[model samples]
Target chain A: MTGSPPAPASLPGDDLLNRIRALRDSPAATDTGLGRELGAVADPLLLHEAGRLLKGVAAARLTRAPATRATTLRVAVAATFTADDVVPLLRAALLAGGVDAELHLCPYDQLGVQLTDPASALAEFAPEVTLCLMDAGALLPRDWDPSALDGVRTAVRDRVDAHTAAAAGFAARTGSAVLLHTVPLPRPDRRSVISFRGGAALGRIWREANIALLAAGETRDGVYTVDLEALFADEPGPVRDERQYRFGRMAWTPAAQLAYAREAAAFCRAVSGLGRKVLVLDLDNTLWGGVLGDDGPAGIELGTVYPGDCYTDLQRRALALRRQGVLLAVCSKNERALVEETLAGHPDMVLRPDDFVAVVADWQRKDLHVAALAEELALGLDAFVFADDSPFECGMVAGSLPQVDVVALDGDPACHSTRLLEPARFAQLGVTATDAERTALYRGRRERHRLSTTHETAEEYLRALGIHVTVGPADAYTLPRLVQLEQRTNQFNMTGRAHGEALTRRLAGDPGHLVLAVEVTDRFGGEGVVGGVWLDRGPDRWTVRNLVLSCRVLGRGVERAVLQYVADTARAAGAAVLEARFRPTARNAPAATLYPSAGLTRAEGPAGDDETVRHEARLDRLPTLTPDWITLVAKEAPAHV
Target chain B: MSDTMTTLRPLVARVSHHPAESLAPDTRFTALGSWGSLAAMRLLAAVEQTYGVQLDLRAYMKLETVGELASEISTRLSGGAETHAG
Candidate 1:
């Protein structure tokens, strides 16, 4: 198998048939490959047919070899009915979501025994997660009538408690996480109660029973419950088909299976700690209706109107995710200044610049920038998910960073939010707010950017905001962040070397090397330790090893003040010249112009090798000074040799 | 092949992993050792979904030949209710 095949233009006629046949013929037929193809089919009947074809190949593959990948998860599924067909569907879903699960399925109606008994084969299998699937018809007694409401209530309570106790007991005994779902009440059962009043009472009892199921999961440590009825309510669908249920023992329809399979995959990933922590969005057709460069701010479709309302809904969804503590960021291919101006002043935009943790809006490979973001946030690449409307960009990011989950949005902005969140890619159970301060910082949005229209110049706005900065020597407290800046900073980093804690300490503590930590605070909030400066205090000329600042503090004058402080300290320490090196990276073009903007003269002749350009300013001349708008606090005295 | 047979052969072939040409009107679904209940139900589902008719389990159990399933589907498609069971 060519792992995951390139998605076809359209998936109905010869194209879809050929893909199914090709995947069926391949020797490396995996559940992931089959599921990926299954995602393309839209119609329910066609989806089932394609799923069957692809699942046939995967079933044969499943029997041949056991999964040995590090991504392989050990899962045990115990369902009440004949769920032989369910095994393949779950396998496809889990594998496509990048989990190779070694599934252990119990015999029919063996859910309780398989869960509770230590001597059982399920115990022998010793799964990491046990999924307990249920059916309401199977739980309720066959002879029971809905006429006696009290008898109905008693039977429901006993059955529901028994099922939950078995699942919770299994979790306690085996230490494997258990996943259960709210059983959708059969429509026939509801319609059995002829009177409207009786039907409502029956519905209320079933709902309370399902709530008990959910509440039971909340009390237990290793058990999780998903509300299938809630899901069925949100999504339009029939819960069951009488013929299928009676004949095939499949209580749920294809729609129910598809929905449950998706949520199950997300639950398995979330409990395994593989859920995404960051959602990287594209700007052009994703955030708005058109391209920012091609269609100017006013020209874009992003207000409260026909097509633009779709984009606005998506922004609201992203804002909701951020409120739940999932950090939002942008990795787009557009001009940074244009993006900033739009993000700051676009009245139609629901998401402001303050919403994003990092905005990498320059023309760089999105994969590289996403990786940089993961490093800057001190997280793993697996914790990030990238969503884009362009298939080209999605393919690139998916190819380069296979760990990151890719949500490919299509032409319809209406479906974008649903596609992005339906998988519950960023959903988690309990979010411990480890950084309460960070959460508080993001609580209130700074409306000053929206007020930029009133200010005559950008400087006047800056002056009104009252920005403050403190540049001091790096101590034990700020060394880790400084080292992170050295490793992670790209655009504003003067030197792109792999620096470790040892070198950072030598720069901070040693007399010859000086490391400065720049902290920033504005009228909005406090941004802790946003910039770093590493310098070599030479006899006659001070050399700058690295000057890296967080992109969050860019457009502000914090970086300029840090540079000025380095120059002033070096000159007072008897250095004749302040020299700096500009090393170029694919992402560091913004850094290339910084030296000249600070009034440093570029050395003409050869300026070192192909990569590094030399910039020097005579300490006696001291052409640049910190701007008055950014007030620098007097901290550590300049330590001279 | 009849139009019913044309559609029936392919569906049975897909579920049973046997070629369409291998199926005929007199073929018993259980004649092949590999043909299990699961495959039978899938074929039943495919038929039900394609023809938009429900084949009762009792009627389905009595089915022994591929030709009988076609006649049963035809009976339901002809606006009759469980009339072909006997």
Candidate 2:
């Protein structure tokens, strides 16, 4: 079937509305195609019209291909003011971000009670995400001491603390990730005698309160702070609409709400671990200014100057991402020696050759090089984000490798850094110690590869590495990496469940559950928390809920060791039978034979039943072949668990 | 100079989902049968954003026809006296 026709740019509001309605009514209009058609429109009015029309499209009637995974996210908004319009905008934004969102907007002025009360709709709804949209006027006390700055600061901090506690409490109860908004600083009133002093005092208090809010958000897992204050400050359009505020208690203008919705959608996407991973950057004018072959190393526009500083700034930003564990790869069509010389000798270059996990400096097509990098790194093509200054290269990669996110740079060099940062392609909810040590971990892979090449056999290579595996219950230190593994590990995943931090924590703390995090360290370096297994502990049988290992640690016999440890632990804990189930996905074919190979007998299934294969390992007759290459260090389960 | 009718007619037409040529100066928003609350708010935001004039809620409520809205917008834009049609 053909895709829906794209709506014309100059179509009148009514015509556009009719077109959108027609698209929705058409049986052949796929959800993806319709979403794309709606998203392509640049004008707000046309987009709004399309959104309004699509709202009428029956949820059941919206047809999608089986391959297209649709995540139904239940989102609750607890705000001080009316969100009737904002809710729709947010829903549209979420749709644009590739999720079908079901929004529940709490009653106005009931944000405090609804969040704190366990019996509130928020609890019953059990939303995946809750947005606490608040205003400064509502949060701060009206009768605080104006003259005494310290008293005001203390009072503000107290109020912020109470609010944070309420939000954290709600998140804990519902397992929903809480997104708290930092209250925007009030606009300074000009009539007061000590206007400067008063503004200063208010700013100080608000700043302190915002900082406290961030700290509180950090302490609680799955709680993220959206800097609404900065969002409003950065907004170019009208932020506050007094008329709407007076009429309907609307805190922000429609334009500002639209912008907020976009930001909120990005945040939600990041929380779901849908953000891009690898940043495949081009050299020459992309990373540095000017062409490498023509300009040479010294002639290139880099260092502390006008256009040169811009390129330097871009490199600094890229380096920041590298530090945050984003794998960097160089895909450039240039003389390899010149590029190496530039990276090695360029005094202004912030990124060194060692930073890149994969370097493709040959005269190959960028698309081919990127695919090769993905293969070399064992990451899905969807995880890569291709960035280059040349529009031709960006377009080429984007057209050929549709999975790779292309950050197309054009115009001035000064705006390149801003443009790269603007899309927030690599936005993640939280960074763990494992994330910070990702570059080094990948570097260790190179060492492992070298050892493999030197050794005659796989067993010899494995035995020479001196691998140590530590198995323990998921703790605070290991929770983030465990969650990351759950989100990103596609190939070695058993169930392919992307369990968030809160759910993982709950599972770890539950007595009937065993959430084991496996940390692997070789003679080279420590690959932090490379695998995780969630199991249900029964009286006489243990069921493996999930078994996931990072693709980086695959083929090292670590999976076997992890399974053996689980079998041993379960047997010791009075379990006669240990069972595992593998739900095969397109990416997880590698894990198809894992359970069977580990000596688990596969049970016969009824004809035309689910593809999920159930395997059972009798604890009484468990396999005793322990590989001498790896030493197992099992820690006692936490007392709380 | 041309009155605010020239600037206001197109916006009113856009919000009311009518041709600018079809809109008369005396055309009542109620007579158009399409100027709902949402349309009214859209018009208000468009006017505020386009012309940098913050229309008073009281004045907006009292406005009946396109002519009256134009006059009110003119008064606000020129910093003239307020007019309460009610």
Candidate 3:
């Protein structure tokens, strides 16, 4: 079947094809179409080709063909007549962000009656994502006797509560998420109509009711609430009679309502785990005003007024991604030295050569440039996206690859970079200890890779670096960083397991378990706590519960030092067998080969089931404990630093 | 070593918003930190009016240091601006 139709004001050209080729070539390539267009490249044909190539690459990566086509969410929506146009607009936003949702229109029919039966209807639907168009009247109920008004008040309130609660429960049960849209409460004094009873009445009750529903759902563990009141405070409003509905007092204008819905829909998609990973960028007309070969660095258009100011802002934003732990690499078609000089010497260019983790700025096919980037960065091909102003290049990548995510932006170039905030490309995990050292660390890795090419064998390259590895018991300061590493490191991670703050505290408190953090330092610099090991001791056995090594330190002989520490320490503690496990992942081939090389015997011990490869090594007979490259150093807690 | 230079310094070095030059004498204490709490307060009747965030007297007083006050004000201002833009 065909892919979902593109969103409104559809971007020009195909995005999926270029992304696929970029991904096939390199999982690390980012879609640069938007940034390049915004960066102001003038050649439309180049823009067309670049965008097409990007789309092809993106499509190939995403064609995983799930056995059962992923279910589209059943969304029950409710909104005021004033916000009638919002649902479809939101749907477009959600679809554009890759959320599979089918709207079940439950538009508000004068509010009170529509909300009364929400629970039974919502529970019957059992939606993966639930959106409550909350307002004040539904939340803050009127003080009326439940027995008198035919039980309407209590029934309405309870149903709204149950609907929200059920949605949250479904999310927590099915691993889906629920969101509540809380409309801003109309300011009371501004909209209050004077009654003969001498009290001025405002329409804020509708907004308050929504918040009450949100609060009721929040009391339970699963439901998450969004504060729309905070979102629409300064939004423009539709033209309304000042005497009716409190006019200027309303927080949102019709235009603002549309904007708010679009933004909310994007957020829902992001939090739901469907986001873009890579952001391929271009050089020459894209990175700066003129071509790098022609502009001669100092004469380039970046870092000045209007168009130049835009690139500066974009660079500043790219740098912020480091804090979020997004790896950045270069895929510009330019002379490597010229691009390097512009990055370093141009005062206007905020991004330096060190900012990108890998560079593929050669005259070869764009498809090949992306492929090399993936190998260098060690990311999956499907996770790539390419953006370029050149549609031809985009089409080339798309036709060549077909699984990468390619976004070929159309319209004004200045606003292209800002669109990078689209919800579909969100990565959920927060920053880890590895994030702070990313740019410099990746730059160091790239240097090592470049240096390795000159040597004949991999061992010769490894021996050249004066590498030192230190392994010891994790203490107060080290535990926080270790926990952070466990939560973020993907490749070389045993099970892709993650831990939170509470779990970190518990790990430190458990005396039976030992947490070891390994420090690696090479010729370039000191890589702080690049490896972590969690060991659980039970009588005569020591089990390795969690083991992860940063990709930055992989193949550097740090893994051996870590295991040796465990074996010797276990022997000292009087434990017998040291069992190490190997779990396979698409990006962890290096780790799958680790166990066999460590001299542990693999056994197939099960019938009626596929045998998991397990390694058994007796701690007592483990070789004469000599930490060849590692020297056990008693370092103070990192906190004191 | 020069008594004349030392005594006339404060009168000569009064700073302004100009980029590291053209500072006037008696240009006010804003030289330490620009658009600070005191200056913000002077600009508007209350913190609630000048800033998007409502400020209690205790909250205002906690900004004892000039730089801290500037940072607090800057954070609130930026947050307010972001909420408005959103």
Candidate 4:
């Protein structure tokens, strides 16, 4: 059963101390881990004392099933000494957090012989995850043997090529996701420099693997790369500062342990569904402090106060999500007028109405609101979470909608800052330069939508927007955002899927997969990296399985651009038919009219509505490109991952 | 499944910062407490948001027995009109 008491009334400092004494004497007072974390004396007592200001509701019957799912993912560790030593600690931490794994430890060897053959050990154990703990030493060459360097580089490239083919073959035979961890070895010595710049070697190898697989022509997919540099970047000051996180002699402190745990959780979540999509946010205290109506535009404290300051920081985080090509939406309630006023005119409102790709405001039922937003935006609700200040609301949202993630706020104004800044819930699958401009672009989308509504005819409105879509193979500059969109976008995504940084590398290693990203720009602003498309390239035909669009660019002939891009690319590649499959999901009904409207012939399929529908269209005679609504321009694609 | 959800309405109202009288089985949880991290982390927010209840840490701590908590909440609902969380 669940039981929580409401926060008591706030008292003056002296009264608060007195109340603390009385509560300490009360029969309800009990010692817990939290108290131990604080000193035995008054810190823990202070926490409870602070709780009194924001009263809580007592619930006796609320019982929670602590997460007991055993993490059955076996992991293999390969790296140099420094990183290799950290593996035991990482493994222990994961085990404590419910991960089930048998650590396969390997030492650093010259020319990556162990890595190439690590497959044999991996095959034997059938590990679910592999961690390549690369040390700075692995990156630097000890003795420069020019002939040996050339021989080793060639061998490394060839080995990657051979393994990619085998892995693609293995994936076709067995449906399993393969991930590669690409840790940049700190270049302590200049000798590691080879044909390409040291940093570029990792990038080049990753791409070679992708190209090999793309050329192989097997639909066998399951390869991804990890980017460590970006992960450590953009973190909070205290988290980034090595001194604070050092914790005495250890490089990774207890706080770092918490950070790593949070990273693992994010990694699991991003890859939870077929791919990562959907980001949910809390409104009120999270987006801004105080109720919209009660505080009014001027009264609702934001930007600088202790509580409001925290909310502002959270808004900045949300903005960062958008810049990475993530789709943003709101599950908040307020007087529509007040919220509008605050978002529009308030100087302190960091997050304007434009930041959200979609929003559910007003007193409507939150579950219904989320469902409607999912439908309108054409996204899956499974990735949705309702963030709100009230526990009652979080509880209702969680109970009524089991699939959605709900984040409840503790009302203590003091702890409000760090509490909201918890990295466990807000981590993104990938980060990119495009991620920084997301909030502003989303605002532009909202403006376009509003303007689209003002037009008498929806189709005419779309045509007038002059949307231009650039679609092409994934290349270096676009690869970061492409992976990010795959991880963050939810609505309008046919197959919600997320891949790792190594996705480009794997794609480049094989010839079978055709990976493409879409960039849409209308008169309003450049909605960069609006969508992503992944398909299997066949000698005689092309089959697209995953196609997702940014909710911001929906209803503006963007889907048409996707079909047109695939058709053109397939034709150029000597494919006759471009087969598009529509998988019915709770949120993707918006795409039901797609194949038919695009003039594709729908063949009879296994009859259930949820069953995948197969559609085929000949490349020779395709629908005319509507230049006014959408102009499909091909951009310089990035080298495969 | 039906009974599991049946007792949920009252539990939600009891645990919620909102009024028990107005809150329905399907009412939103944000009407009461401010949307903050304390509640989200405590509840894990994925399964229990709709029920307006969190994983009772206080109960897990042995501060109060389950029966004592239920009786306390019942007494509060039945008589006390103050804005105490029970």
Model 1, which residues run further than 4 Å from truth?
Answer: A1-35, A41-71, A233-237, A247-249, A291-299, A374-380, A399-403, A435-641, B80-86
Q: Which structure among the candidates has the greatest DockQ?
A: 2
Candidates 1 and 3, the one with greater TM-score:
1
RMSD of each: 15.4, 6.0, 22.1, 17.9
Candidates 2 and 3, the one with greater DockQ: 2
Q: For candidate 4, write residues A440-546 as lDDT tens digits.
A: 66567557757866899987887778888988887766766766565555556664434444554465356898778788888888988878887888998898777
Error of 3 at A136 (Å): 6.2
* A1-641: candidate 2 lDDT, tens digit per residue: 03532222233455545555666789565443444344344444445545555664533333221112234567888888765566766765566556566788898878879988888887888888898887766656666566676877777788788888888887777778899877775443212216578767777778888988888677787788877778778777546666667676777777777767777877777766667778988887888888889888888898889899999999999899988989888888899988888888888889998888877798878898888667656677877888898889988997787567678777898999988886566878888898777777777776677678799999998999999988989887887789877876767888665667777888898889879999899988898898999988999999897899988788888888898899888988899998988887767888888888878988766322386678897888878635778888897766663
Give the C-alpha lDDT of model 1. Answer: 0.73
Return the interface RMSD of the candidates, in order shown, one decimal each. 10.5, 11.6, 27.5, 14.8
User: For candidate 3, lDDT tens digit of each residue in A1-641?
Assistant: 13532222212232432343455488755443333231232222223233223332322123321111123445555443333334544543443344445655454433333334445454456554555554444443445332333343344457466556555555444333456655554444223434522222223333344666668545543355666666565444432212223321222333454555555665554443234445566765555566777768877777658777766666676667645555666677789888777777777777777667776777888877776766555544445666666777777777665545555533445775765544336454234465567656656666777778898987778777667777877766566567656644667776544433334445546777767788887787777888888777877888776688977677667787777777877887788888766656554566776667776767556422352455768886676443354454534434321
CA lDDT of A9 in candidate 2?
22
Which one wins by DockQ: 1 or 3?
Answer: 1
Best by lDDT: 2
Q: For model 4, give the TM-score of chain B.
A: 0.32
Poorest 10 consecutive residues of model 2 chain A by lDDT?
A60-69
Q: Which stretches of candidate 2 lie over 4 Å from their true place?
A: A1-23, A30-50, A54-70, A142-155, A188-195, A444-469, A509-512, A521-526, A554-557, A579-617, A621-641, B1-39, B64-86
Ranking by TM-score: 2, 1, 3, 4
